[model samples]
Target: MIRFGVIGTNWITEQFIQAALESEEFALSAVYSRTEERAKDFAAKYDIPNLYTDLESMAASDQVDAVYIASPNSFHAKQTIVFLNHGKHVLCEKPIASNAAETKAMIAASQMNNVLLMEALKSTLMPNFRAVVDNLHKIGTVRRYFASYCQYSSRYDAFKQGNILNAFNPAYSNGSLMDLGIYCLYPLVTLFGKPNSVQAAGVLLSSGVDGEGSMVMSYKDMDAVIQHSKISNSYLPAEIQGENGTIVIDKINQPGSVRIHYKDGSVEDITVPQVKPSMHYEVKEFIELMKSGRVESTVNSHANSLAAMEVIDETRRQIGLVFAADLK
Candidate 1:
C-alpha cells in the first residue's frame, strides 16, 4: 500500500485524511505540525501511525512513500522541495508556489530528484469538471464565461479589527487569488488554454491584501470574467455562454452537478453524485496513480499546473499584487 504523510494538520488536512482512510489503496501513516499539541491531536484523531514535529525528520523517515502538503501558500515551495529532494513523491496543495518563479524552481527540483510531483487541484479531477470539458464541442463557439468563488471568511471579523490570521495574512503568500480564484483559473486554462490578455481589479484590505477581486481574461473570440472574495458571498452560478448553448456549473470550486441550456429552449441536466465527499475525487485519483506506477494524471498533468500558474502570475502582475516573499 502507498503510505502517506502530510504537512500542516489544518482543516483541509483532516478532510483529506478522512478521504484517504475511505480509500483502500492507500494509508495515512504520518503527519507534521508546527505545534506539538495540534500535531499530536491530529495524529490521534485520525489514528495516524506516526507524527513528527519537524518536516526534515518526516522526509527522512521510511514511514511514508509520498507526502501530502496542506501547509499555507507561502510554505508550499520550501516544503515541496524538501520532500522532492528526499526522493518522495509529493502531492502538494494548490497555488503550487507563491508565483511562477517559485513554481519553476519546484518543478526543477522534482525533475532533478526524478520523483513525481503534483499539485492537489482537487477540482480539476472531479466528474463534474470533466462533464463540462467533455461537452465543449457540443456547447459550440464559446462567447463568454463567468466563474466566481465567494465565501465569508471565518476570520473576517478579526481581519476587520486589525487582527490578521494566517489565511488573511499576505505574508503567508495567500489572498483571494491563491485561495479562490485558482478554482476559476484552473478550469479556464484547462478548458480554454492561455488567454490573449488579462486585466484585473480588486479591493485590497487595510493589510494590503486582496479582499475580493474581478478579472477579465480576453481570448480571441471568447472572454472569461472571474471573481473571488474573502469577505462576502456570491449569488450567481458559474456558467459559460456559447453560440449554441450555455453550460452551467452549480459550484465551480466544488461542483455537484451540471446542466446545459440550449439555444432552442431545450435543457440537458447532468448529475454528478458526490462520493465520500467532493474531495474524494482527487484522493482516489492519486491512489490509482501510485498503484499503477503512473507519475501524473492526464487530466491534471504537470502542464496544467504550469498553465494555471501562468494565468495566476500574470493576473497578479496586471493588478500590481506583488508579494515581498515572492522576491528571491
Candidate 2:
C-alpha cells in the first residue's frame, strides 16, 4: 500500500485524510503542523501516530511513501524539493510555484529523484467536468469559454482595515486568482491547450494584492475569459458557446452540475449528483496514482501542471504581481 502523509490541517486536508482511510490503495500514516501543540491535537483527532514540526524530519520518515503538501503557496516549491530529495513522491495544491522559474526547479527535483509529483486540481476530475466533456458534441465547434468564480470574502473587510490574514495577503501568495481562478484555468487547459496569448488585468487593493480580477486567454479562433473575485457574487455560470449550442456549469470552481442547450431548443441536464464533496475525486485519484507507482496519470500529468503554471506565471507577470520573497 502507498503510505501517505499530509502537512496541513485545513478543511480540505481533513476531507482528503478521511477519504484515504476509506481507500484501499492508500494508508494515512502521518501529519505535520507548525507547532507541537497543533500537531498533537491533530494527531490525536486523526489517530496519526507520527507528527513533526520540521519538514525534513517528516520527509525522512519511512512510514510515508508520499507527501501531500497543502501548505501555503510560497512553501510549495521548497517543500516539494525537500520531499523529492528524501525520495518521497509529492502531491501539491494548485499554483505549483510562486513563478515559472521556481516551478521548473521543483520539476527538476522530482524528475531527478524519479518520483511522482502532481498538482491537486480537483476541478478536472469531478464527475461534473466529465459530464461537460462527454456532451460537447452538441456544442459543435467551441467558440468561447468563460468562467467566473466570485465570493464576498469575510476576510475582505479585515483586509480593508489593514488586518492582514494569510488568505488575503500577497505575502502568503494568495488572492482570488491564485485561489479560485486556478480552478477555471485547469479545466480550460485540460480542454484546450495553451492560449495563443494571454492578457491579464486585475483590481489591486491598497495592500498591493489582487482584490478581484479577470483574465483573457486568446486563441486563434476562440477565447477564454476567466474571472476570480473576492469582492462580489456573480450569476454568470462557467460556460461554452458554439455555432449550434451552449453549455453552462453552475459553479466552475466546485461545479455541482452542468446543463447544455442546443440550437433546436432542447435543454439537457448533465449534472452529476454526488453525496461527497467535490474534493473526493482528487483524493481518490491521488490514491490511485500512488498505488500504481506511476509518476503521473493520463488525466493529470506533470506536463499539464507545467502548462497551467506557465499561464499563471505569465498572468502574474502581466499584472505586475510579484511576491516580496521571490528569489531571483
Candidate 3:
C-alpha cells in the first residue's frame, strides 16, 4: 500500500483522504499542519499515528511514501519542492502554482528527484470526461466552445461587510480565476490544445482580486469563451458547438451529465456512471502510476499543467490581476 501524508486540514483535503482510503490502494499514514494542535485534531478523526507540525520532519519521516498538498496557492511551489527534494511523490491540488514560472520550477524539482508530481485535477480523470472525449467526433468541425462556472462564495457576504478573507486576498494568490476559472481552462486545454491568443476582462474587488471574469480564447478556426465568478451563480450548461451538433456539459468542473444535440433534433446521452466519489478517480490513477514506477501521468502530464498555466498567466496579465507571489 502507498503510505500517504496530507499537508492540509481543509474540507478538500478531507475529501481526498476519504477518497484515497476508499480506493484501498493507499493508507493515511501521516498528517501535517502548521500547529501541533491542529494536526492532532485532524489526525484524531482518521486515527492516524503520525502527526507532524514541521514539514521538513514530515518529509524526512519514513511513514509516508507520498504526500498530498492542499495548502494555499502561494505555498504550493515551495512545499512541493521540499517533498520532491526528499524523494517523495507529490499530488498537488490544482492551479499547480502561482504562475507558469513556479510550475516550471516544481516540474524541474520532480524531474531532478525522479519522483511523481501530478496536479490533482479531478475533472480530466473522471469517466464522464473520457466519455466526452470518446464522443467528440459526433460533433464534426468544432467552431466554438463556451464554458462557465460561477458560484457565489459564502465569504462574499462577510467581505461586503468590510471583512477580508483569503479567498479574495492577493497575498495568498487567491482569486476567482485561480480558484474557479481554471476549472474551465484545464478542460479546454485538455480537449483542444492551447489557443493562439486570449482576450480577458474581469471585475476586481476592492482587495485587488477578481470577483467575476470572462475571457475569449482565439484558435485557428474556433473561439472559446470562458466565464467564471465567485460573486454570482450561473445555471447555464457549457456547450461545444460544431457543424453537426453541440456537446452540452452539465458542470464543467465535475461533469455528471453530458449530452449531444444534433441539428436534426436528435439527442444522445454520453455520460458514464461513476460509482466512486469524483476525487477517487484521480487518487486511483496516482497510485497506479506509483505502483508502475512512473514519474508522470499521461492524462495530467506536466506539459498540460504548464500549458494551462501559460493561459492563466496571459489571462491575469489582461485582467491586471497581480499576486504578491508574482512580485517575489
Candidate 4:
C-alpha cells in the first residue's frame, strides 16, 4: 500500500480521503493543517495516525509515500515543489497553479525529483467523460462547441452584505473564472486541441475578482464559447455541434449523462456509469502511475495542464483580471 499524507482539511480534501479509504492501494497515514487543533481533529475524524502543523516535517516523515494538496490556489506551486523535492509524489487540486509559469516550475520539479505529479482533474478520468471522447466520432466534423458551468455561490450573499470571503477574494486567486470556468475550459482542451486565439469579457466585483465571464476560442473550422458565473445557476447542458450530429453533455463538471443527436432526427444515450465519490478514479490512476514510475498522467497530462493554464492566462489578460501571483 502507498501511504499518503493530506495537506488540507477542506471539504474537497475530505472527499479525497474518503475515496482513498475505499481504494486498496491507498492508506491515509497523516494529516496536515496550519493549526495543531485542526490537524488533530481531521486526523481523529479519519483515524489517521499522524497530525502535523509543519509541512516540512510531514514531507520528511517515513509514513508517507505521497501527498494530496488541496490548499489555496496561491500555495499549490510552493507546497507541491517542497514535497516533490523531498521525494514524495503529489496530486494537486485542479487549476493546477495560478498561472502557466508556476505550472511549468511544478512540472520541472517533478521531473527533477523523478516522482509522480498529477493535477486532480477528476472529471477527465471519469468513465462517462472518456465515453464522451470515445463517441465523438459519431458526431462527424466538429463545427462548434459550447460549455457553461455556473452555480450561485453560497458566499455571494455575504459578499453582497459587505463581507468578502476567500472564494470571491482576489488575494487568494479565487473567482468564478478560475474556480468554475476551468471546468468548461479543461474539457474543451481535452476534446479539441488548443484554439488559435481567444477573446474574453467578464463582470468584476468590487473586490477585483470576476463575478461572471464568457470567452470565445477561435479554431480553424469552429469556435468554442465558454460561459461561467458564480452569482447565478445554469440548468442548460453543454453541447458540441458537428456536421452530422451533436453530442450533449449533462454537466460540464460531473457529467452524469452524455447523448447524441443525429441529422436523421434520432437520439441515443451514451452515458457510462461511474463509481461513487468520483475522486476514486483519480486516486486509482495516481497510485497506478506512481507504481509504474511515471511522472505525469496520460489522462490529465502535464501538457493538458499547460494548455488549460494558457487559456486561463490569456483570458485573464483580455479581461484585465490579475492575481497577486502574476506580479511575482
Among all candidates shown, the one with the greatest lDDT: 3
lDDT of 2 by residue, 184-236 (tens): 88888888888889999988777777878889988878999999888888878
Off by over 4 Å in 1: none
The true-versus-predicted C-alpha distance at residue 124 of model 1, in Å, is: 1.5
Give the per-residue lDDT of model 1 (tens digit) for 155-238.
988887878998778788788888999988888887888788888888877776788898998999989999999899887789
lDDT of model 1 at position 114:
76
- Looking at candidate 4, what is the lDDT of residue 140? 93
Cα lDDT tens digits, model 4, 19-70, are 8778888988999999999998999999999999999999999999999999
Tell me the tens digit of each residue's lDDT in model 3 across 105-191. Answer: 999999999999999999999999999899999999999999999999998999999899989999989999999999999999998
Estimate the TM-score for candidate 4. Answer: 0.98
Show how many residue pairs clash in every candidate, following the order shown. Answer: 0, 0, 0, 0
TM-scores, all candidates, are 0.96, 0.95, 0.99, 0.98
Residue 22, candidate 2: Cα error in Å is 3.5
- lDDT (Cα, 0-100) at 218 in candidate 4: 93
lDDT of 3 at 116: 98
RMSD in order of candidates = 1.4, 1.6, 0.8, 0.9
Clashing pairs in 4: none
**Candidate 1 lDDT (Cα, 0 to 1):** 0.84
- Alpha carbon lDDT at 316, candidate 3: 94
Instruction: Note the Cα lDDT for every prediction shown.
Output: 0.84, 0.83, 0.94, 0.93
